[model samples]
Target: MLDEIVASRDAAGAALTAEVDAVIEAANAMSDRFRAGGRLLAFGRGEAAADAAHVAVEFTHPVIVGKRALPALCLGGEPALLGMWGRPQDIAVGICPATGDLAAARSLGLLTVALTANEEFPEADHVLCARSADPLVAREIHITVYHLLWELVHVFQEAE
Candidate 1:
């Protein structure tokens, strides 16, 4: 069982490395918005909704050193609320659902990040494709990805 977890981690790491560049770019964009006094809004459906909230909590209340608190919130799987709350400077992260309409409004200018499976592609400024087939593995990878995002966004935040 331990080996399984280790192997999954190894695979996830490799996959992440392959997409690191795109991740960096998106993080920088997110940081720019944050620096401009924008907020982090995370949304997803079903189980992913909970994950979105978790990500929001981590950002709003950092557990790490040198990472100041940032404005963040979870939409609790509700995309419609975004219509009212989302701004051109905010960043929206959709965990596992279609966000095609999330940024359809041309002037919304919301930096959108969509993490999903290959078959579930959607319109997003950044699309992070998950590499795991098992739900457990996928969840683990998702956690790792968001953790990295939180960390890197701070790095870019410091730059600005």
Candidate 2:
């Protein structure tokens, strides 16, 4: 049991480490959008919907003291409403997206991000794959990725 737990943690760490550069790039872009008056809109289906809500809360109500609360909304995985509310400078985040919503958001001029366990996720401005076959492990990885994004977005803003 201990070995399995360690392996899962290691896998998630390796996946994130491999994608560190991508995360940093995405964070920089996200920071730019926020600076230009963009809000973050997160969505997902089924179990992932909970994660979307969590992301929204994390941004809108920062857990860390001194971290500014950013504007964010959870769309409950509604694709149509994303189009309705998304603006040119807003950020669209899709959790375990299985639809073309991210691509659609991109077309609408919003910066799009997709977090998934699928080997082939739909095209988006930023796609972060958890690289785990197990759903539990993937979920863990996805959670970490979003936390990193939330933290790094602030880091970029502070640096500027």
Candidate 3:
């Protein structure tokens, strides 16, 4: 099982390298939006939701001990919000509802970045499409995508 995981990871890395430019472009776009006083919002379902939460926490609290804060949000933060508000077909609506407890957060201005294996949210400012070949592979790709996005945000913030 371990060997299979390693092999899959290796294959994912290779495939990701081939699409490096697209990844970079997506990251840069997201970074730009984030740097513009726009909070980064991420959401997914099940394990994907867990991944989104992990990505959000990484930005909110850097693991590097001492680092500047980066503004980010996980849509699943409030269970009530998730339950009461119907999921939006588009990410913009999901993250920027006019009413509800999240209205205050949305008023602050946020850019929604949806990470999904499905192409459901077309209106998302930035969508990191998870590779659906394998669950492990998708997780690996999502992690890489998150890191690239964080790096891009760092650079963009530094430049400002």
User: Which candidate number would show the highest TM-score if scored against the true structure?
Assistant: 2
The window of 10 residues in a row where model 1 has the poorest summed lDDT is 98-107
Ranking by lDDT: 2, 1, 3
Clashing pairs in 2: none
Per-candidate TM-score against the hidden true structure? 0.87, 0.93, 0.65
Q: Which stretches of candidate 3 lie over 4 Å from their true place?
A: 1-7, 77-112, 118-121
TM-score rank, highest first? 2, 1, 3
lDDT of 3 by residue, 1-160 (tens): 9998788778767766776776676666656665555455555455566766777787888776546677666765342343333232212213211224333323334334544454455444445555456776777777777787777667666666
Instruction: Give the clash total for candidate 2.
Output: 0
Across residues 30-147, which tens digit of lDDT does each residue of candidate 2 receive? Answer: 9999999999999987799999999999999999999999999999868567788999999999998876768778888999888888757656888888988878888999999999
Task: Name the regions of candidate 1 deviating beyond 4 angstroms.
Answer: 1-9, 99-101, 104-107, 119-122
Q: Assess the local accuracy of residue 121 in candidate 3 as a C-alpha lDDT between 0 and 100.
A: 52
Candidate 1 is scored at a TM of 0.87
Candidate 1 structure quality by residue, lDDT tens digits, 1-160: 9998788778876887898887888888889989898998888878999999999999999998878999998899887677788888898888886545466422487888877755355468787776877777777777877888899999988876
What C-alpha lDDT, on a 0 to 100 scale, does residue 153 get in candidate 3?
61
Winner on lDDT between 2 and 3 is: 2
Question: Between the candidate structures 1 and 3, which one is better when assessed by lDDT?
Answer: 1
